[model samples]
Target: MADENQGFMGAVWETIKTIFWALIIAGVFRTLFFQPFWIPSSSMKDTLLVGDFLFVNKMAYGYSYASCPNIKIARFGIDIDADDICGFLDGDNTRVLAGEPERGDVVVFRHPVTHQDYIKRLIGLPGDRVQVKEGLIYINDEPVKVEDGGTFTEVKEAQGPERRFPRCSNDPVGEGGQCVKERQIETLPNGVTHSTLNITDRGDLDTTKVFTVPEGEYFFMGDNRDNSTDSRVAQTSFGVGFVPYENLIGRADRIMFSSAGRSMLFFWTWRSDRFFKGIE
Candidate 1:
């Protein structure tokens, strides 16, 4: 009987060791290779949508302090930010084996002041002057090419887990009605073209003063245009100002999976078309 008990105890110990090592491997893989990111807002509409789930390529721009995972689960009262894990690497604004990001690449970076993760399209590189005038972007006094791409339409209803309703150029749209926004294809100086949405012709951000990006910093903007609070607004005013290179976490390459419903568990709401869709 003693022999039987000893054998059972040995088996349980082995099982525990296996489970422990499995968790360690997963944690290392997530930290060093890829980190999962879910689109929680409509800022990158038409390119990325709410409920879209993708893994950020941590190795694309190499490792930085911002590459550390920031886990925040409100229900569990657990909040661990990237700074908490890699604060030693912060302040220097440098990445190990850093790679330069292109002008039009969609990037994920930590807010300089808030330290929160934000994803937007790179607009201005270091030492570049960026400005918006009459709903058009001007880089170094030269207006980038913009062509009308007709209207983008969607249902006027609560979307995703936040249940937020989308804004429309044709406002006053009732629930379940068609919400519309003007779409325009913008070609950057580097010839990278992407669709941008405009909800209003005369929004506050439609025109802005010339912002000369500082050395080692970058300017970013959202594809949603008037809806996003990005580099156009200063960090002191609660917007993402110029982001430093080290704050960059990674690049978003593609959408691995997407759902339209409030919860991902609702399999019927899955968007199969967006599965494995490459981000332009």
Candidate 2:
């Protein structure tokens, strides 16, 4: 019986070690190669939709990775220990990260203010004048063409006992969370532009802050124009006022998968039509 017990213990230790090594290898591959991301918002509508699953190529832009970059905390190979001044992942320009961001590509970044994740198109490059005018988006005086219309509906239903229900409808106009509006776009003299609503004639963020698109910074804006709180909304436009190269998370490559409305239980609500759709 003692022999049997010893054998089982030996197998358990071997299995545990195997798992540890496998996880370490996988983490390294993902960090330096590709990382997966899930979409959670509609800020970039008519482009990337809600529920879209995607993969980001981390190496494309080059960012360093270490077990702990900014944490003074240490691990005992099994648990936590005491602390010290945190050391960052980069060892004084180790050159672990490399590459440049391009124009017109959809990118993900850490929100300068909230530090939350967001995705938008690259527009205003450094030193370029970025502005929105009378609901039209303009970059260097040229217009950013947007489709005439893009509207989606989100629906919710109530079950028995919990409810006096609101009316149910397939039409977007009557559906909750559904929005319908025309967006306008235009370009600026320096070539950076943004979007707006065609008839939101007088908006609070119409002008001012004639930024000279500082060097090493980039500008970003949502495709939904009137509905997005982007670079135009002064308070949240940091990093991209403009976006320094370091702040970029990754570029949107392609849609892996997406669910319509909100839930996946409703098979009919799936955007089967959009499956494998190419992203611009």
Candidate 3:
């Protein structure tokens, strides 16, 4: 009886160790190479939909200290704070052999004011004069070539907490209402083309003053024009404006998986068409 009890306890201990090591390895890989992110809003609409799960490549953009999590915090490694970590830390210029963000790259960064995670397309780079006039984007005084892609209608139901999202909706008018939007393909100066949705040609953000992206700052905007509160809004107004280089976390590489968000156990809501889809 004693021998059986000891064997059972040893087996449990071994299982626990195995799980712990597996989690540690996974966490290290996620931290160093890629991080998974979910689209929770309609800001990116036609490009990246709600419930889309994507992998952000950490190595694509150079890493700051804030991008690297403290491994010591997990109690798996030794603690070594460069600036004396006291339960909180700020951005430190710690480049770990990575590249810089480029124009038209979809990036994830920490919000300059809220410190929350946000993903948007990199628009105006350093010193770029960006402006939106009558629903058209002009970079450096040259209008971005935009071609009509026809109309887009959202026919799906909202899932998770996004059901309460009071932005552009599938049922725009009301229940059983038609949600129609104008679709257009906008080509950036770098030739990176992505589709955009416009509820109307004349919306609040559709007309804006020329934004001169300052040095060491990048401007970001959502593909869902008229709906997103991005670089178009003032930073002091609680909107993301001219994100610093240090705030960038990574570049969104591809969509790993996506769901319709009706149910987790129900497999019918899975967006199989988006599985392993590459993000443009």
Q: Estimated TM-score per prediction?
A: 0.95, 0.69, 0.86
Instruction: Show model 1 residue runs off by greater than 4 Å.
Output: 1-8
- State in Å the error of residue 109, model 1: 0.8
lDDT of 3 by residue, 212-278 (tens): 9998789999999877879998895378889888777799988988887644455787889999998
Q: 54, model 2: CA deviation in Å?
A: 0.8
Worst 10 residues of 2 by lDDT: 78-87
2 against 3, candidate with superior TM-score: 3
Q: Note the clash tally of each candidate.
A: 0, 19, 0
Task: List model 2 lDDT by residue over 118-166, tens digit each.
Answer: 6887767776776666555566666456444433333433312232222
The parts of candidate 3 lying over 4 Å away from their true place are 69-89, 92-94, 165-172
lDDT of each: 0.91, 0.56, 0.79
Which of 1 and 3 is the better model by TM-score? 1
Compared to the true structure, candidate 2 yields what TM-score? 0.69
